[model samples]
Target: MRPFLIALWLLIMPQVVQATTDVYPFESASEQERFRELISELRCPKCQNQNIADSDAPIAKDMRDEVYRMMQDGATDQQVTDALVSRFGEFVLYKPDFNQRTALLWATPLLAVLGGLLVVVGLVIRARQQGGAEPPLSEEERRRAEQLLRDRDGGV
Candidate 1:
C-alpha cells in the first residue's frame, strides 16, 4: 500500500505541473472575448495549419501571450493582426489580404470551373450537330449493301 501511494503520487505530479497555464485577467468580458477571437484568427507560425488558440507549439504560446499583452495595451484587432503579420508574414493569417500576388491564387478555381463548363458545352454542341442517327446511306451505297447481302445469301 505504501509503494502504491508513492507510485500514484509520481504519476499525478507531472499532470499537475502540466496543467498550469498562463492565465491573463481581462478588464471586461468583452476584452476576454476579443482575446479569444484574435487568438482563434491568428494562425500559429510553427504549426502552419493550426490557429494559435488551438496550437500546442511554443510559438503559439508566445503569440497568445503577445496578443494578450497587445490587447491589454489597447491595440485594436487589426493592430494585433498587423503586428503578427509583420513579424510572421501573411502566412500567419488564415485569410490573407487579396493582392496582385494572390489574384491568380483566388482566380484559379473559377478559371478551372469555367474551362470545364466550356468543354462540356462544346461537347454538347458538337453532339447536337452530329445528331444521334448516322446520315442516311447514299443510294449507291445502299444498293451495293443489298447486292452484297443477296450474294452472300445465295441470291435469295
Candidate 2:
C-alpha cells in the first residue's frame, strides 16, 4: 500500500511540474502586464485570426518568448513591437503603423464609401435627367396609340 501511494505521487508530481514549466516567463509584474498588452495587439502568423496572447500555437509561444526577452533586455514597448513587425512584416500587427505603403489600409474603406456615394449620386442625376427628357409625340403616333387603347378596351 505504501509503495503504491509513493508511485502515484511520483507520477502526479512530474505532471504538475511539467504543466507549470510550460507557462512562458515574464520577469516582473510589469513585464507580465506589458507582455499581455503587446501580445493582444499582435496577430499570430500561423493562426491569422487569433491574437498572439490568445493563441496556443507553438509560433505564438515563440513570439511570446521573444517579447519577454526583448522586455528583459530593456527594450521599450514600441521597440519590441517594431522588432516583431520588422521580422514578420505588417501582417503580424493587428493595428498597423502609418506609412506610405499602409496608407491604403487606412484610406481604402473611406475611399470605397465615398466612391459608392458618388456612383449613387451620378445614377440619381442621370435618372432625373432621363425623367425630364421626354420628346413630344407626333400627331400620327398619338392617333395610333389612342386607336390601340380603344381596341383593347372594346371601343368603350
| Weakest lDDT window of 10 consecutive positions for candidate 1 | 14-23
Best model per lDDT? 1
Per-candidate clash tally? 0, 0
In TM-score terms, which candidate is top? 1
Global lDDT of each candidate: 0.90, 0.86
Candidate 2: Cα lDDT at 89: 83
Clashing pairs in 2: none
Q: In candidate 1, what are the lDDT values of residues 29-138, reduced to their tens digit?
A: 99989899999988998885999988877889999999999987889999999999999998888878899978887899999999999999999999999896788999
**Model 1, C-alpha of 33: deviation from truth (Å):** 0.7
Model 2 quality (TM-score)? 0.68
What TM-score fits each model?
Answer: 0.71, 0.68
Candidate 2 C-alpha lDDT tens digits along 9-99: 9989966764543465766887778778998999999995899888877788889889878878899989988899899888888888788
User: Which TM-score value belongs to model 1?
Assistant: 0.71
